[model samples]
Target: MTDLTPPAKRPANPRFSSGPCAKIPGFSLDHLADAPLGRSHRAAIGKAKLKEAIDLTREILGVPADYRIGIVPASDTGAVEMAMWSLLGARPVEMLAWESFGEGWVTDVVKQLKLDAKVQVAPYGQIVDFTTVDFDRDVVFTWNGTTSGCRLPTGDAIPASRAGLTICDATSAAFAMDLPWDKLDVTTFSWQKVLGGEGAHGMLILSPRAVERLETYTPAWPLPKIFRLTSKGKLIEGIFVGETINTPSMLAVEDYLVALKWAKSVGGLQGLVNRATANAKVVWEFCAANPWIANLAETADIASTTSVCLKFTDPRITDGETFAKAVAKRLEKAGVAFDVGAYRDAPPGLRIWCGSTVETSDVQALMPWIAHAFDAEIASLAAAA
Candidate 1:
């Protein structure tokens, strides 16, 4: 583990990382002490808290009354995996991959499950041609690819009469965007993204059709205890009602409950979206003023309001990888932000999470430091030149 030693001087402004982003303003560990500790997850108190989180998720999203929501394992990754393993084997599947996370789903199809699947892929800065996906086949996509900062505007591209289902990994888009539930059959996200809670729990929401599929079609492979979606060919009712198949972190559950309460107080889902949009606009305006900085995803309309990605335009720093790493290192050293580097699989850029939990003023304060970080690296490169 890295040293937790206090720095000689602390950053005047708080840092903003993409995932495990900033927490709700004024949040503290003191609140966590009151969380129902040492309580059995199956106990009435634990169940009541977990149930509250589930209920709040539905209320904030305005999910259809017929849909079922449950807490799952491994955060967003686990929620998506659960849907894939439990619901995909019986159908002809169409997988759309635009960035690293979407590509992960493709890997799950080809390598892990080894299913016969048709894959449509797009480069990092662009979205897949929505018209190309055969709605007749089971469709899988990421609502917002966290790495690329690109997303599909809506599922209107999905044909209305198609017999297939749409499964979406909406890890980064959940509460920040209007998810068209009529078109999505399975939706997955995590508390750590828009919710700003600790990780290790995934939220899975299934449409009526998804539930039907789980009850009717069984995967040929033997599922591990955690991946099983049904019991004796019947969808387990209690799991969706705060009963988990395996043990989960009660502390994490409590944190999620607190997040849900905060979400409700801030005008629920719409408020969350507003906060992210407002924060992203600050970064976008900064990019407009600084000629050296531009968005990796071209088109402001398509830009992500949650993860604002920035690319440097300096030809002198042609190797975006080197420039981005150095800038991120400098920012970390300054204690202005940590983990601001582009994802390894992505082209070099700064990816900042302008999520609901982040304060717009903090983003405003941090922008100058981002410029300083870039300037320091560029100056060093020039000295070497």
Candidate 2:
């Protein structure tokens, strides 16, 4: 029942997981030869390397001159929690969720912190209505819902003069999409995403308003040492300048520096966006021609460009979960692709990474393999019938 006639070509690289995505096309361990291995992070050389990573990040991301950026512990989650615990209790909160990660943040606000929060949530594959949110109440949400394959269509929902702060989880969105920095008060992302760097640390970007919030308000709950951004009623300016609270992985830092350098070499943020947009077009065109396969996202405008998700619409597939898993397993077994399965919390479908680090050519090459796998699954269903 399998399709023995394989495609003429295969994806050059088959490492498309949602996170820790494909590395730069020419990436090699040889590039990290200069990493300060075994050197004390507090040493002058170690400090200089860390500062270099920070400077390049700011320059490439085009962060505002006044905003503060810091390399924090954990991944994006730590950055988000630090902002939440340090600054949230000062005002009433609005928790909006459309996917697993968003739901986790909602749980933290309403149940754990027990704040006076209004929860607005939507089912997977759909977005919540931004109109229902009260801007006067601090709003927390995921800029890109990675699991459900949806993203914020625009920042128009947030007013510039709004009284409350906007905290966003942009781990999967940052480099691949345009973030309205003026509209966001606190934004968090990790290197494991679009940059194709290691996931040893997270990046936290704070607007002037976010800094003011930290200076003016402190949560009643206890703050862990790692989450502390202020000391004795004043902001710790050193952390914002590469003085990390804990020892960081110099190896990971070197890897991230390599990624940043590559990003600049490719024409900065717009170039990265173009790569992701072009890669996602391949999935869009495939869905258009193949009636059986369709995007899981409900709306085209809000669809994810990085983690492209698709569901099967054919009548022959009796069990969506079983059939989708079979298709992904077949692709993985053939070595044409790997980890293309839908996220555990998402709908039964296929999830492909189309971030900047993933080559459009690789995505184009993988299409035939996908079709072969789908056709093979269809044949299996017919045989079973």
Candidate 3:
């Protein structure tokens, strides 16, 4: 007896991809008109633009004055690889993973780097116990599991006084959550995440301790030019000061600048956090009101505000993967949502992005459509049977 009729209300913006998320509410190509086209990145104009991006990032993120922020190649993956190749292998390492991306890092460390790292992992909806971890060893973890829709509630478990560094992949969490900067020695993110900027650029923020590690420790293996952070046993200061190791996409840089400006106008980090929190609340409320669906995150505290994952729990459902895909397809076909399917490696469910660029009203509008799609899919399954 479920109402299968489509919802008249539809989200104006249907981009809900966790990465390369929805653009700012009023984003326009005109914002990038000032991008310096056809100019060398090393030129004065390019360097100035890049420096402004760095300065604004520090101001918005409230990064410490002694920390270093650099624009690196690739996206978040590149930034993470660069940090691992350059800074790890200096000490005993422990890798924590609860999602696909984190598992990839473990593979890189265990198989590629051959670091003999101790790896602790949990199921998709769960997180490893932070208290049981040894902070004395170099620790690498994701602040938010992009694929799992689970996140660390706080950085309190990390000790203030530890012998090792804490490297964090915070691509989806930055700008949308409270990041404990003091506890993180190396944090990496990409332009395409919360800000909805273009890709091919990564932000690498390093604490003083990370810099000391870079300057003193050298990996046993030779590093590629792009991964190298130190030269002649000294941290490459220019890399942190607008001098990139390789050429960059000025257009993408301009897009990031525009997004950063938008972030500031929305009250910077706290503002961005509020928007994401509110957006996710809409979906959380929807799940609470509906008995057939629920959050994929086992606990509310560990649930992600940016990539809010969901699972259908109807007893009538059969073949979870196909049912989830059918529901997502119905929503997509109805033009109410896009890219709402769960990650392939994750539990069968939906992953709706509720990042800062997404509006609360749009999320409110999309929830009804999800119910509509679910009802239609369920009826179709019954007919097929």
Candidate 4:
């Protein structure tokens, strides 16, 4: 096979960063030419754009009438923290953790909430034993672990008749996977993931049960005005409307609108799923042919269709940390991909973002370059040995 190095000065292609994935493939500055750049977010026109974004997201995701969708503070992390702070004190909580993002919530529950809690955790590449968890307690988990590239097969594993709330950090899984909306009490994600939009905001969806919990139960910790979901113990109606607790960037709101429009034009949620599935398959096929490479995730069914985790099989670099760093650097130097590094909190393995915004053609181009990088790195290691 031929080495896949580009001629010197070639521009980046197949960029595989996990957060801000490729921007709508052919996206250009022309798309933003007519955007209102200098308008106040509180203006009638800006509010109208925000309202449209909320409606489009609701329609695209098939969100139920009983739920409340709000554009909230920060990105995915902020939305999750708002939910945790605003909604937790009512029930005994169980936090499920398998990767960095999941573990972040666990830290918030134990260290920040100081709640009476239990943690169910597993190392990178492994999943928590679902059978061992009690559904009667409030549960927090990531539908897809972007860092580890592992995901729960489905929300079906969650007990149907559980009395406590189910809160999910679905930033990476939102548009790319099938979410059992009936089972989720609270869900949070960001536009920067599957939609490939500007960050700085998060989307928080709350089921009726969650709203009821907020109305009846109050958290002990002091909540910022922005995190409060209720006005004098009554759910806020304006949040679901065009009203926001704090000002939001109009530009980001416009980007989200553009992304939602693209998502709908491509056939809505199912189309997004198809794009992610196709991109991930390209990586899977490459892994199957490469003897020295394998997915860090164990099973095909459990592996993420959004972020594909991979690692080298070289025995000499048995330390996952060493191998992951070497391979990532080689790929970066070759210009095959960028920010294709392992999560600092996750076990060492490359995490490639394969969200819907990333193109399958880009992934196809990336695979051969990956093989070339691996061969070059391995040879260098042997030479040093």
Q: Top TM-score: which candidate number?
A: 3
lDDT order of candidates, best first? 3, 2, 1, 4
lDDT of each: 0.85, 0.90, 0.94, 0.84
What TM-score, computed on C-alpha atoms, does each candidate reach? Answer: 0.95, 0.98, 0.99, 0.95
For residues 314-336, write the lDDT of model 4, one tens digit per residue.
67675668767877887787677
Residue-level lDDT tens digits of model 2 in 1-385: 4555879899989887898788887999999988999999889888888889888988988889899999999989999888888889898999999999999999898888889799899988888888788889899999888888898888998999899999999999998999999999999999899998898699999999999989888789999999999998888988888889888999999999999999988889999999999999999999999999998888899899998989999998889999999999998998978899999988999999999999999999999888888998888778788
> Which runs in model 1 stand beyond 4 Å of their true positions?
1-13
TM-score of 4: 0.95
Per-residue CA lDDT of model 3 for 1-385, tens digit only, reads: 8777778888999989887788888988999999999999999999999999999999999999999999999999999999999989989999999999999999999999999999999998999999999999999999999999999999999998989999999999999999999999999999999999988899999999999999888889999999988889999899998999999999999999999999999999999999999999999999999999999999999999999999999999979999999999988888888999999999999999999999999999999999888888888888989
- When summed lDDT is taken over every stretch of 10 residues in candidate 4, the lowest stretch is 2-11
* Candidate 1 lDDT over residue span 343-377, tens digit each: 88988889988889888877887787777777777
Give the per-residue Cα lDDT of candidate 2 at 112.
84
Candidate 1: residue 237 Cα off by (Å): 0.5
The positional error of residue 6 in candidate 1, measured at the CA in angstroms, is 22
Off by over 4 Å in 4: 1-12
Clashing pairs in 1: none
lDDT of 3: 0.94
At residue 307, candidate 2 shows an lDDT of 88
